[model samples]
Structures are given as C-alpha cells and as structure tokens.
Target: MGFTVRQIARRADGGEIIRTRAFDGAELSVGRGSDCDIQLADLGLMLRHARLRLAGDGRVAVEAMGGVPLEIAGAFVTRADLDPGDNPTIMLAAHRLTLARGEDGGVLVTAERVLAAGDGSDAASEAQVFTLKKTLPSKRRLAWGLVVLILGLGLALPLWVMAGRQTVLPPALVTAAARNAAPVATPASGWQPDRVWSSGPLSTAHAGLANSCGACHAKPFEATTDTACIACHTPAAIPAHAPAARLARGQVPATGLVADVHKAFNLPEGRCASCHKEHEGPDGALQVAENFCTDCHRGLAARLPDTRLANVPDWGGHPAFKPTLVVQPSLTAPRFERVALAGARETSGLVYPHQLHLSTRNSVANMVRAQGLPGKNGLLACNYCHVPDSDGERFQPISMEKNCAACHDLAFARDGGVVRTLPHGKPEQAAGIIRDFYLGQALSPRAGVAAADRRLPGSEARLRTLAFTSPAQARAQADAAIAGIFGKGGTCAECHAITDTGGANLLTRFAISPVTLADHYLPKGRFPHKRHLSYDGRTGDAACISCHSGVPRSNLASDVLLPPLSQCATCHGGPQLATAAPATCATCHGYHYGESGHGGDALRVRLVVARRGE
Candidate 1:
C-alpha cells in the first residue's frame, strides 16, 4: 500500500524515521520526497484590519492530498513533495495554504510549520495533515482599552454633570464650598483673587472669577445677612480664630471704631453687598472707596486729637477730607524742625570781627582798579560766610583752619603755645611772663599801683627769687597762675570786653583787651598789617572793604562781606617800599609807639606767632 508520512521522526545520517498519523487520520510511508514547505501567496493578508474567525475549535485543518509519504506534528503539516528534479511538485495542506485555486488548480498558504516523511510511502497519512488556529489577544491590550474608556467618561461625563448641578446647587451650598476653599492664611506669596459683585448679572460678573472667587469675600453666594457679614468683615468684633482674616480686615483696634462709624452712615443695611462684593470684575481686588474713612471722621473732628487727624485746612470750597491716609500708613505728616543749634557758640573770648570783615565793596572796587583785575572776582558777599537760615535763626560753627586762617593765618594754640614755636623767649618763659602779667594786672587796682604799672618786676629780680625754688615748684606755680588768669568765668570784662562802641583796646583801646602778654604776643608770620594798609587798590578797594567794613547800625558784627587777604601779601611780599625802613628786629621789638612805622612790636609777634602755629 502506498502510505503517506503521518509524523516523521528522524535523525540525519542513516537513522530510522518514526511515523505518526496526519491530521486527516491517515498514515503514509515516510520518505524524503514527502516533505514540503509552505508560504503565503498574498503576504498582506497576515495583517489584521478586521476580525478573523475560525471554522471550528477556532482552527483550520489541512490534509495531505497526493500519494506521498507525509507527516504532521504539533503545528507542522506536509503534502506531496517531489524529487529534487521532478517538476518540483508539492502536496500542500489546505489550511496552511490559504489561496483560491486558479483554473490551473494551484493553492497558496502561509505555512506555520513544515512536516517531513519518515518512510517513503505513496499513501495519505494522518501525520501529513495539520490544523492552524487564530491566536487570542493578550490580557494587557484588553486592560489598556478599558482604562482609556474609564478616563474618557471621567473627563467628559463628570464635567457635563457638574455643569448641570452648578445651577441647581443652593446658593448656601455653593457659598460654603467657596468659603471652605479660601486660603486661611494671608498668602505669603501675596496672591489675591479678583472680586465679584452680586448686583450685576451673574454671568457677566462671574467671568472675573474664572480661576478663583474665594480671594476676596469670606463666602461667595451665601446668605449675607447683616449679622453674618458684620461678624467677620467688619472691624468691631475681634476675629477669634483667624489672624490672617483679622489682618485682611485692616482695621486695628485704634482705627476700627472709626471705620464702624463710616459704615453706619455712608453704607446702608442691604447695600453692604453693593460695595463689598465677593468677586468683582477684573482689576477689582482692591476697590473700596478712597473717601470711605474721611466721610465720617470729618464730622467728629472735635472729639479727635489734631495728631490723629492731620489738621488740613478747608480751602474755601474744596473738600478737605481724604481717606487714603487711613489705609496707607506712609502718608502721615512730616515731623517739624528737630535739629537744634546749641553746640555752635565760640569757646574763646576772642571777638570774631564779623562786621569789619564784611565791608568789602569799597576795598574790592579799589583793588580791582589798582590791579587792573575784574571787580567781580575780587570780593564775595557776607552771606558767603554767615550762611542764611531757612527755617530759623541758627549759627554754624566757623572753621578756624578754613575760614579764619585764610586771612588771619592763625593756628589755634590749645595750651597757650606749649607744643608750638616760641616767640622772643622760650614757651615756658613766655607762658610765665603771661601768667605774671595777668596776676599783676588783676592786683593792680587793689595794690594801689598806677594804671601804667604794666611791667612785671624786672625779669632778673623775679628770676633771682624763683631760682631758689625747685623746677617742679616753679612749674606748679606757673600752671596755677596761668589757670587763675585764664580759668572759666575769670572776669572777661577785666581783660576782654565787648564795648557799646565795639572798638577793643589793650591799655586805652586794644583790639582784644586785658593788657595781658599771653594774648598780646603771638607768632610773627601771620598778618602783615603794614602791607594791608598800603594795599592801595590792587583788586580794587572793594576787596579791602570786603572784610574790613564796619558793622551795620551798631559797631558790632554784621553779615555783609568775607575776610580779606590784603594783610597777608603785605609783609610776605618781596622788597621794602622805602630806605627809611629799619632792618634790625629791635626796631619793631618794643611795646611803645615810635617812628619805626611798625603796626606794633608785640602785635606783629602775636600775628606772626598765630600764623606759624597754624
């Protein structure tokens, strides 16, 4: 009998082929010619565009047709197969070959498995047929589909339901949700929600509340009965549980009472909702009336302090009340003049020639003509030195180095020349001389000495008496004597005095007074008084008069001109004016008047010493 290969089991290189029944329940001989390979004729059909179904058991079965040894096992099936050169014939399984037969009787299929013949047989075999079943989809794909459906329902259907429910919710419930959703704290992030007014159409006004409505009102659409609104929104009651809420009300205990009065008169009962809306239109977060505070406070001004309500005058008919001051703290009145001038007076008894230094016009004009220099550049007005007062009378301290030294060329001597150059004698000796002169002058009226008793006991005689004492004792005595003479409250009138006529005098009429040698003798490099007197009109006499003008109305100082430099260039300049002038220093040494033409021997020393010390 010619049998097909049912199921071929074989090993290569001379092993026996085991046979099994084909899918058609037939058996056949196993042989090499019985094996066949299958493939799809139309490859595009494998892709699933539409659902596919199987005939039975969700499978399609194929059978071996021709008399050839064939076999089928698991997913494998075989049909007739030809020898290597015999027209290449093949017996394909029907199910594995899914092509419509042409007029020439050909078949096509996508072979899932191949079968081989174990024995050479020309008969059909059960192992030569195979069946193919369509596969079921995996669980993961089904699960993903279900999830997509659920998400679609959640997004679309719930939104539709919420839209309908929003209209039906009682205003109280909606308001409760809004109030609960509001942030409890004053957002550190400073985010504020727009306000909504209930007066207008809800649709028109609700646009402003698109993202949030709880930003402004405590509760959105709730029953805002006067009691409920006043409890939280008004300033009168203390916000019990919420500190942020209290701050939002902006009504501190001191000012809250004032706000209450405003609400009582200006805003009516049911109308609270009008101005204090929950969610206003865009740009309505801070929309309270600016005059809300002042409207009520103006009537009660009599009861409040001027400080509490800045005393703004009512200008004719203009409304004087402003409410912005109540809300913004930075707009308060400025504090009036708090700077005092008590620490700016002179510490020394030297009378600053405020008036004499102020007369610059004549000196400046004459100097300008003589020097052929511009008059404008010669002298500055007095206001330059004595600064004006904007708010009140106040004197600023004069800088000795800057203002005084410009003309006086004097440096301040703290311990009466202790640390500076000595003039005509050692500083200690000069200090002693000054101390004795002060004491002798002090005792003169009592000692029955003549007013001309200006000289101290001869230096040689005084030294003979003091020579027997220790140096320490001498220093101590010198310090004591100097202190008594220049000590605080040491009878300034006895030496220095501001006369009614304002002309100072030493013996008869000194520039500074007291006839004491310490104030009398100074360094010699300071002002050259002779040069200043001869300062004709280099920059015009206006420059000379700039600082030498007399005081106005009185002989005291005035604010008219600055100090002049005519005295400085006089002695400091090169060459002498005439041959009669003496060269020896003694000609200008004595304290008496002479034909030497010197301003004064001691006065020159005082001026020069003051300058060098500076």
Candidate 2:
C-alpha cells in the first residue's frame, strides 16, 4: 500500500489543515497523479535532499543524497520513511525540490532510499518516525496575576507602616530632630576637677633664679635653649651709673656731661655705656662706640675751634681756651688765622675785607664815620642789604632776576597799555630769543638791517634786520658783543661789591665754588662776607654782628644769618640792580651770539629789548 501527503493549507492564519490519503487495495500507484502525490514528493525532496519528478504518466524518478538516483511510486500519505502502523509522523523538507501533478489522480512519486550496488533488495532496514505537537500551559496567566499582587503590596507597604506610628514625620525632619537632641545639656556633678595643664611647666632649675626667663632668653619658650649668658652680662650698661645718677639729680648740665667725658678720656661727645652691653641673651644689645661720634662731629668741631674748648673748665681765666690739637684729618691746609689784604691785588679775583666789616660794633656808626654820606643815616643793619640765615642764604652768586624779584615786582609792557608780570630770571624767554636769533641767521642773514642792529620788529626793526653787508663785518660785530658781556669787569659788580681795602668779593668767591646745583640760575656759592666788607667800607662798615646778632662767632661761617630781600631793597632800588642798557641785550647776557654758516652772509643776533614804546 502507498501513502500520500499534501498540504491543503498552511498554518499561517490559525490552525493546521493538512490532507492525507492511503491506498491499500490496488498495486499502490506511487506517482505524481494528484495534488497529494505531488505534495508527498515535494516533502520527501525537502527533508532528504532528494529530487523527485514525474518521469512520464505514472513512474517517478528521484535523485537521493550523495547523488544516488532512484524512482518511487506512492499514493500513501504517511511519513516518507515510516510505516503506516508507526506513530503518525510529520516530515519537513531539507532541500527545495520541484513537484508536478500527474495525469492520473491516483499516484504519488518521491525519491526512494537507494542501496549500494552490492547490497541486495532484501537487506534488513529499520525506519523510524515521530510526530510533533505543541501544547501551552495556563501558568503564564497565573504569573501575570502574581506580578500584579506583588506590585500592589509594594505600593501599600510604606503607608501601612506609617499608619502604625504615633507621630509620622518626614525622614528629613526626623533626622534633623535626632541630630538636635543628641547634644542636650547635662549639668556638671558637684565635685570640682583638678587644673588641666595645656603647656609644659618651666624647668625647676630656672624657677628660683632672680632673673626673669626673658632676661636670659631673647625669644619665647620654643626658641633653642642653648644660648650664651656672658654676652649680655660682660659689657657695661648704657649711661654709666655715675653720670646717669648725676643727670637724674640735675646737678650737671648735659653739655657738662659731654665735656667731662671728653676731658677725662678723650671720649668726644661721650656719655657712658655708649658702647657697652648690659642685657645678656641670644640677641645682642644695640650700642655703638665713642669712635663713631668722632667720624661726623670731628669735621664740624675742627671748623669751629670753640667746639674743642667746650670740654675745658674755667681754669682761672686760662687765656680763652684753645683747641689742643685737631682731632680729624684735613683736606686742605688749615687757616687758623685770618689773612690780611694789602697792596694792588689781582684784578681778575674777588676782593674782600673781613676785619673791617666784622670788627665794627655798630655797623651804622662805622658807615657814618667812614663814607661821611650824611644822608646815609648811620650804618645800616646787616639784614638791611645782606640777608641772613633766617631768610635763605642770599649772599650766594644768584641770578639777578631771581634774587632781586623776591623784593622787586617785575612788569613787562606789551603792545597795548598792558603790563604783564615777568618770571624771575626769565630763562625760558632768554633761551627762546637766542634760539630765534640763530634760526633767523641760518635762514636769511643778509635780509635785515645792519649786522650791529640785532633787535626784532617795529621801531627796533633796524636791530632785528641783518644787513651784514659782509660776512667779515658780521663776524667781527658778534665777537665784539660777546667779549663785552663776559669780560672781567663787565657787569660783575653791578649787584655785588668789593671793599675799598681790596678784600675778596663775595660773588667771585661763590662763582668759584658753588654750594648746591639744584637752582641752576642761582650761583652755587654764597657771598655774604664780601658783600658785608664792601658795603661797610674800609674804615667802618656793616658788622657781622648786625645780622648775626645772637649767633656767636664760634659758629661756622657757613652758618651766617640771612634776611629777606625786601629788607635790602629798602635801601637799594630793584630797578637800579636789574635793568639792561637801553640799546643792547649784550648788557645782560653776552655769551649767546654767533652767525650761521648756511646763510648767504653772517648774521648778528641779539636779545630783544622790551621798551615802553615798541
């Protein structure tokens, strides 16, 4: 009997719908005669890697695994390799095979299992088959129901716990409350406690010592304990006991103290313990020795001879104490006595008479007696002309405009009836005039008036314009003008004075050695001595005592007193001391004159004059 299997419908939509047929009575026609035959053949090829096809109307041809070929005929619907009595089985295709309906509807064809060439058809073979079926349990539904129950319990667990509590506060609030309650105050018990030591106690060895710990130790306790004790104890104390005790009692003057120390041991400005040590410790005492004082005071002391005499006591009028010897080194030969001025002196040098001027007791009386100028009104005080220390040192070589302007008010007349206050010295204006003159000469030398006429514009046009006529003429004229201003006797003593006895002039001395370079316009050195001697005249003149009334001669010459310029101008008019000659600028500044090489001809440039009219 042959069996046939067919797939009436696939299991895609819902359930399986397969059709099977069995042909047992007739010689089982095994061919692809019906859809069931075709289906069986296709199923066999798919599962066994077999190819099946209808050879003709009834016969079926098949090629099996490993290229074995065979033909089979079947109309049975059973597992291809299974008997009908075996448990119903299902076969799935292993490879794709073509199937076609045969002309007759009774046959089914499939690839048959073939035997080796040597094997007979009667060889024993066993065929096995199995059926497949799927069954699902209802446990999935129960699992879903259990999951819902667990979730519900999870949601209600916290609420139930809260409901049981008497006071249900938020977790954060509970935590805060617990923290606050943990440190509640608890009162101390009745018994008192022993003192707790935070720092180590001082060593017992040092406790009984009379000195404080600080006396031996410069730093606090933590500092290194190893330190020298003798450093502080060995040296003498400041302000030795004898002098200090005397000073405390007010028995001796402070100057007396300075003198006594110098006289006894040549201590010079000494007062005990100046260089001794009293407090001993790690950090040494801050004291200097007597030698240091000699460094600075020595110079000053040498200049003023009386400084050394301070130490000498009144030895029953021992002929006005004099210095025993100079304590400091000297830079130049010493002039202990004043030099005399006699005979015709050097014309180019300054002349002064110190004795005549300084010796006069009453300068006004001396002046009245010497000059015999009845209107002179007794000799004037030193401050009347030569200012003293109280004012700035005005005796120095200073610019006429700067020193004079302090007392005299300067006015410059402009084009209209306008007068402007001019700056003292007018350095900027002077520089500008010089620069313009040089520039004009370089640009056009022969364009203006005569070379001698060096003025600028308007009525002074003749002076401003340069009619050099020739370069030689211009050069000669410029040279003459410059020489006239800087010449030895030119304008040197107009503001300064030399004594009739031919003493050194203050201005000349100051010019030689200036004191300070800060004020460029002012001469560096001072001239009070020269001015005093000259104004006083040889017979009698202003006395040094007039201005330096309270100051002793023992003081340094550099320490001379000074007065205001207003005081000097009271006698000497400011105009007489300051004005230049009407026709020439060289009368004031003569050093700045020259001709430029670039110009066609030489040009003589001069300072501009500010006259009332032009």
Candidate 3:
C-alpha cells in the first residue's frame, strides 16, 4: 500500500550518507528531478524516469516512464514483474536500486552509485563502454545485404533472365489462355515468372487486357491518363456536363469535412472518378450514394446564396414542379412556359372538352363504345384517345386521323359504295377542294341518288339537293357550302379556330388556324402511363382518373389538366415519408442533362413518321 526509499551517497573520504523517506501511496515515482519521490542528482536521469507499482498478486512491477529502458538482472527492459523479497537490482542511469520487503509488509527501495564520478572519464573504461564491435550486425551491413538481395533477385536476376530469352514473347502468347495451354506438371507455357511482381489481379472490366498492360501503362512508373479510358466512354454528341471544372466545383460546399479531406489529399474537384469509382471487386452494382447529390444540393442556398435553385435535401424535400405548357397560340412560334400545374392553363388553339367525351352518357362516349374501346356503361376510357407507345413508357402523339376522325368524320360527298372524306390539317385548301368537287359533279352527275342516301347524318346532304346545270351555278353553290362549313355549327369550324380573311367575303375566303397539340406537357418530369394506370384503384372503374382528378371535369383543351403536386405526394414522396411508395430526388430528378438519363415524366420520345424519325 506504501513505499519507503533510502538514498545513499559516498563522500571523497569513502564515508557513506543515507537518508530514508516514506511515501504513503499505491505507487512510487523515481527520477532525477525534485518532483519525483526518489530524486537523484545525476544529470543522466530524466524527470519522471520510472514508476514502481504493487500488482494484485503482491509482486512489484517496475516500468520505465521515458523511452530509455531500466537495467534489471543484467538485462535492459522497459517493464518487468518481480518479487520484492528477492531483491531484484535495477540500474537507472548511474544509480543502482534494490527492492526489498519492509517490516510493515511495504516496499523498501535502496539506491546507491555503482561507480565513482571521476572514474567515468578514464580513457581505458570509456573505450570499453563506447565500442559496439559485437553488440549486433551493423545497420549498414544489413541494409547493403538487403539491397544486394533485392537487386540480384527482384531486378537484376529478372533482367538477366530476360536478356537470355531467345525470342520476344508476343502479348498474344502471354495471355491466360496461352499460359494454361501446357500441362501444370512442368514449367511449360504456365511459367510466366514476371507475373510474380503484380500487386493484384486485373478487375473484371479490364481482365481481357491483363496480358496487354501496355494499352494503359504506356510508360512505366506513370499513372494511366483519362485519355486511355475516354476512348471507350465517349459521351453523346449533345452538350454534356460543364466544360469548365470550376463551375462544377462551385456547386460543392467550399467548407466541409469532406472538402477538407479532399483538399488535404490535393484532389482536384469534379473528376469522373469521384462517383464512377471502379475496380471495387467488379461485380457489385455501381450506384452512387445519395450523399453525392445532397452534398452540393442540400442547404445549397447557404453555400451559394445567388443560386436560383431551391435546396432539395432529398426526394421528399423537393419543391413543387412547374410543368411546361405551350403558352402561345401560334404554331410557328409557340412559346413554352413552366407554370405550377395547380392553377395554370395552356394556350393550344383547339377547343376539346375531355369531360364531354369521357362522360358515361355523352354522345362521344356512345360513339366510342360502339367502336368497342374497352368501355362499360357507354363511357370511354383514357386509353381510347391516349394510346401508349410500343414501350408503354409514354403515350404516342395523338393522331387526329386515328383517334378523332372515327367519330368526327369530314365526309362531303359520296360515290357508289364509297364516302369521300376531307383532307385533315389542310384547312386553307378546304375551299379549293369543295369547289372542285361540285364542279366535277356538275359536269358528270352520278346516275342515281342511292349513293348519297347512305351518307352519315352530318354529311352535306343539302348541297346535293341544289339543282345546278352549269359550272358558274355550281361554283356559287360551292361558295355557300364552304361558308356554311367554315362558319359556326359547321364541321370544319367546330374544333378548329376559323377566321374570315380581312376585306374578304366569309363565303369565299375563310381560313381555319391549324390546331397544335403537344406530345409532351412536362419536359422536366417523366410519367410512365403504364406504371400509373392503376395508382388509385379505389373505384372499380376509372382507376387512372383518380389522381388526374381534373381530367373528368376539364372541358377546355387549354386547361392543362395535370394533377396537382398534392395529389402526387399522396402516393409518391420523400424516402422518409410513411407510405407504400417512398422516393428520393433520383426517383424523379437527374443531376445531369442526358435526356435518356432523366426519370419521372420527362417525356421520352420515339419520333415516328410514317417511316418514323426524330
């Protein structure tokens, strides 16, 4: 539990002086400084040189505090466990210490000088103390031996073997397939001794080039440059990520732990290897972590105060999407503007009411059911008009000739067993067509009225009733027919915007504005109609219309009846949102500008002409 120390000193006359001091603590400290319990005057001792502590088994454990080891039983050691009664001797600098059991079952330490101070400077004893002839082999000898061994085996021997090689081995002969051609029993083709120096095997992506390392390592001891990889990963011809790396780095937070680490490593900003790291065993999926995006995007306003983008921590923390809508009436220069879908409207120059066509009891639905478009109770489904493309990722561009012409027939005349239809999308030429039809009929009228009797209810039956014997009379009648059709309640003017040319008679010079419908409403978001056709199955019928709540009530083509953000968030939200479908920014947003890379409702298009084109 305690220790007592006796310091012994010798005078010049060979007389000794001893002073005993008691220390009542669990441990004892020895050193040359006055701060230690057993202080020595010798300059060779350090301040707080060693410590002696009582072990649980009642043995005294001595340990050096400084780097120097204490000499115990002629052996230099930093630590040792010994019994006090055995009187183990320790040499700390010039002092000789002995440990013994005291009368009170405590530790007793006695210290004395082993040699006289004057004798340490003697030339004969100094040579014996300083010489290290047989202590161990010289470090220079071992280092030179290792150098010789490495040069002889690791380099020189290999070079010598290479010099003796009669013929240079082509890369094709060094391949793993070639190396394994001979039997394993002998040093045959499998003996590619140079492979022993490789650090590791090639990754699976580059495994084929293992025998041809020169493809990338063109110069030894130099790293492979990006030019070696760019030969394979060429980006699309379209504009790619920023050409200036500073602009890319500007998005990263200027001060962060990761940024500090990257700075310490002298890593430049915005390299492809940051996210596209390879050689990670080659088989695992190589998806970038969400933090890669959130690092620069989360709290971006604080780091880059001037940016217009909202800080999006994740998918659930996104701002409301402003959907792109055609905002101009002119087809030649239609301006697209992004507006929040909640209360926005489009400017398409057509007048279609979805509710009227999709209603269960409407005439449009009756006609649609007659054509058998997967309807019930005489209602038309969304698929009747909005047909999906071949991949079902998006709807094909709506075709007036296919979807609308079935019911909105533009028949103006009839021959035997054939009803003639007007050409669509050429409203300016409609007047000429009407004039020619009547003139041809005036020259050669059909033999019977039976052909005209079979025409639909809205056909130009009244025009056929007019009695015309001359081309001038037929021309006058055709003018009346064109005006009646281009004006209100006429077939051509019902869906299209018709206008009478300035300073011209409405009967002869009326022009209908071409109707333009966009293939995509939102260019920044993507919607796979196939995936969402059953999003809300609450109702047995009209499952697709539940989220698109406005479609059933929307009557105007310019209404832009996209569902509101609140409606979509009900099912799709941030990853942390408590729902069946959890999403993140990657769920609907993209960090890059590739059209194919963008997800969500970013309209993926397959341009199809009659023979299809982009």
Candidate 4:
C-alpha cells in the first residue's frame, strides 16, 4: 500500500549525484506552506500547492490543495492516482517530486527544481505568466499548434473552399453530384488547398495527374481502388509478367504465419502497382528488376498445367528458339509453321551452290576478279549481295538489276553494225524480235548480185510481199528460238530452275523461278544487328561467319542457316557462367506488342503539363 519515490538529478559535470528522503506517509502534505508535511521553497508554487495520501482502497492519490493544479505525468490535473512501486513522478510549479517505496512499508518523497523560473520583466515571460519550469511554450503547446494547423489548413480550409465552389458550380455538375450523393470536385480557385495531403511528387510520366490527387487516392487515407487506375489506363493494362491465376490459385494454401496474415487480408496476389510503386523518391518511375518476372515464370509449369506457353525462365534458362518459316513453296497460297532452326529446312525454289561462287579458286570467283568486280580479295563477300537497309537493322531484298546484272549480258544477235539485245525477262518477246530479223534478211538484196540485184525500184512491192511469212510458220520459228533459250544449257537456265508449262499444241511457255525471302527470321524477338556487330568478347568485332558457320559450306538453298542458342551462349549466358555478358530475361523477349515494349516496358510518354506553383 505504501511506496517510495526517489528523485535522480545530474550535477553541472553530468555526474549522477543522488539524494533521498523517507517521509512517514500513509498521507503527506507537499506545498510551500509552513504546516505542509513536505516543504518546498519555489517562488512559482502557491502556499498550499497539493496534498498526497494513500487512498482507502490501497492506492496513492495526489490532489491540488486549491484551484491551482499540479503537472501529473506530463499533464496538468487536479487529482491523480500514483503507485509509488511504479516509481511515478509528478511536478508542481518549478519543482519535480517523485514517490517510491521506502524501508518498512513507508513512502519516500524526492523533490528537485528542474527548470529556471521565467523572468517577469522579459517580453516573452509576460505572455505566459504562470509558466516557471519552461520559460518558453511546452511540448503540449507546440503539439496543439501543429494539430490546429493541419486540420484548419489541410482539411478545414479545403472544406470551406468546396462549400464556396458548390454555390458557383454549374447546375449540371451540382445536380450530378447531388443526384449520386457523391462529393465530386468542381473547378475551384487557383490554390489546390488540398495538396497539403499529397504524400510526395508523382512520377514524371504521371505528373499530368499531379494536381488531381483524388485521381488515384480517391478516398481519404484509404487504399486506392482499381477503378482509380482503370479510369485512364483502361486498354493498356499494367504488365503482369505472368497471368494472375498462376500464383493466386494455391492448392493447400500458404502455411506460414506471414502468409496466413496476408491471405486473411485478401491482398492482391497480382496487382499492377505492387511492382510499379510510385512517389518513392526524386528519381522518376523505376523499372522493375528481373526478379519480378522470374518469380512467377520460374516454376510456372507446375502452377498452370494446361498453359500453352513454353516453360522458360530468364534469358540464361531459355528453351531452344522456334523460328517461323513458310512451309508452302508458293506465295500465291501462304502457309507458315514454326520449327526449331537447328534442323529446319526451307523449300525456296532456286538452287544456290554457295561454295561454287564463294570459293577463292573457283571459276565464278575468277570471272568476278577478271572484271575487277565489287568484291574484295578476288572473292565474293556476304555484303556484295546482302545490302543492309538505311537503318542497318536488316538487309534489303536482293534485286537482279541492282546486284546481278553487271556480270550477265542480254545481247543475242548482231548484223552490219546493228546489235539486237534480247529483253532479260521476256522469253516470248525476244523470240518474236528474232523471227522479224530473219524475215528482213529474206527480203534484203544480195551483195554479190551487183548490177542484177539492183532490179529494185519497180519490183519493191513484190519483194516486200516475199518478206512476209505465213503466221503458222512464223510462230513455229519463234517457238524454236524460245525453247533453245529456256532449255538446260541456255543463258537463262544457268541460275534458275526452268519449268515448261507443257504446251504441245501451242508454242513454248517457260515459267521463271518462284522464290520468297524474308529479311527478318524471328519476328517476335528483336535482334539489332548493329548492337551485335561488336559482340566478340575479347576482340572488338566478330565476323558474320562466326555465328553463321555453315554459310561458307552451304551449297543448297534449302539449308536454314540461323545459329542455335548454344552459339550465342558462348558470350551470353547465366550470371554465374564464365561468359561476361550475363544475359537476363529482358535481353530478347518483349512483354508487349510494339517497339516501346521491346525492352519489356511501356513507353512513358512525358506530358509537359503546366504545374501549379507553390
């Protein structure tokens, strides 16, 4: 029932010099008055400041003697319960008193003057007359001031402005808000007034919605709803690396305590902002790390058993590439199929014996060198025909006129300083020109006839008639010429696969080569050739043949020459792999549809909106 209160004090040197007093007290009087059981001489205290005693129910009670109250537990109160065993301390005026259990069930009281009394003549002291312990305003005073400032400015001022807005708001908006019983914002004064509650600056991308805090945090201090985001970001949903159902559908459920708590809260298993958090720092939006994507994709096969997606983790753990190729030989009817490039074959019609043309000692290379051609070192280079586009991302499709016409000539007939060239592509037209030439020969006067051959002027009409041949006979001669040119060893047959349309009754009809070449092999993955031109680890740049090793020996057009993933892994591999590239999940695979999505990120369009000044 009885206890002691010991007061601890520090001297000028910061040493703990302690002094104690044991007062015989089931009841004690503590004041500046003479008759008080505990006397204290502090100018700030009244004659009879407070009375302390043990209550009938075995608890200590302290009460003010008159109207003046004592500071109890940092609060001013007229009465308070004190358990000395708890080592309770109370303050009166400039003096601090502590109560504690003393020897033999008696209570001990300790007192010390903690602060200097305020000088009455000072201008600051005149403002607060009764304050002695604190010459300045106390913590309570400052705390109350802050509370008033927040409520009056952050909340109350905005409410007052909103009320003012309601009067002038257009009838349309006012009626809409009233009809729905919702507090919708109307155009207000320049001062946003409510921005005092804004946590921090919005990301540079989202800075357009800065003034409109309620655009996201609609409710006061409440979590943002999906509706807030969906309002503007409807079609462009946040990229959720993997589908939501994979992780959200747990079988036996999470067993750990933290997991249980999370489950109980029904926290979103796949929320957009979970990974893309905002208002963190001065830096705008930060990109999510590789762990965000790998976490869901690592063991995804087990989670979603029926998923059609190829089970792949990060770039290092990717599966073999699947390249799309046209299965049908003709462009008239398209058919596509994705097959692994390692053993994939192409059925592009023309046959290209790569070794014959590329060989240094071969006849074709020798002919190219004899002409002092566009190639280097008396040999054909890949770039001689495979020219890159303006951007150098990929090669332009090869053209016969631009790339091949220099070595091949179209001339077929020459007579008397007049040379006739057969049109390169038109077989029938070239034959007709040949037939007309022979008809002109039959009509011309013979050079050896001399005087007799000049029987001419009067007989010109007769001679011209002899030059014209029967349509059937002329067609037959033209067909023969066309056949010879389209045949196996003809000029046109050297490079192309010749096919006759089987016109037995009619003449000859030759069909040219049917070939289709794609500049890009893998449409889904972006491989910037410019970036890879210098991908050799130690040396500055690697040759194209380093990756396409089969190109030098690839004789047939059917050989699919794309390198396998193992070739790329020599430099680009796992972080722990010896290679320095350390490829991650984002190197090749894009999560979205456009160039903006090439790096698995959305294009953050920074709107240059005019900001409201502070």
Q: Residue 251's C-alpha lDDT in candidate 1?
A: 25
For residues 1-614, could you state the per-residue lDDT of candidate 1 as single tens digits? 11112233335684656443212222221112323221122212221111111123222233333432233333333332222112222233322222222222222122221344323221233233331222545578778988887765644544444344322223433453344332222212222222122343222223323333332233433434444444333432212221333323322232476658645554332234533354344424224432332232333244433213232122112222111001111112211111112221212334444433333455433443444432243443433443323422222344444333323221112222232211321223544564454344344322322211111111111111122134445445545433333333322222233232322311222122212112221111122333333234443344345334433322332122223223323332212323223122222222122221112322212111111101
lDDT of 3 by residue, 228-326 (tens): 444433444212443454346446744678778767664446555565444444431134556666777787677656555578777657677676666
- In model 4, the clashing pairs are 3-100, 3-101, 4-99, 4-100, 4-101, 4-108, 5-99, 5-100
Top of the candidates by lDDT? 3
Encode model 2's per-residue lDDT on 123-170: one tens digit a residue.
121121222222433678768988887655543443343344343223
| Whole-model lDDT per candidate | 0.30, 0.30, 0.64, 0.59
Which should have the higher TM-score, number 1 or number 2?
Answer: 2
Q: Model 2, residue 455: what's the lDDT?
A: 22
User: Tens digit of lDDT per residue, candidate 4, span 118-154?
Assistant: 5342233545566565666778998999999999998
Q: Using alpha carbons, what is the TM-score of model 4? A: 0.53
Name the 10 consecutive residues with the lowest summed lDDT in model 3. Answer: 605-614
Cα displacement (Å) at residue 266, model 4: 9.1
Candidate 1 positional error at 355, Å: 4.0
2 against 3, candidate with superior lDDT: 3
Q: What is the TM-score of each predicted model, taking all chains together?
A: 0.19, 0.22, 0.58, 0.53
Estimate the Cα RMSD of every predicted model relative to the unseen true structure.
29.7, 39.5, 15.6, 18.9
Greater TM-score among 3 and 4 belongs to 3
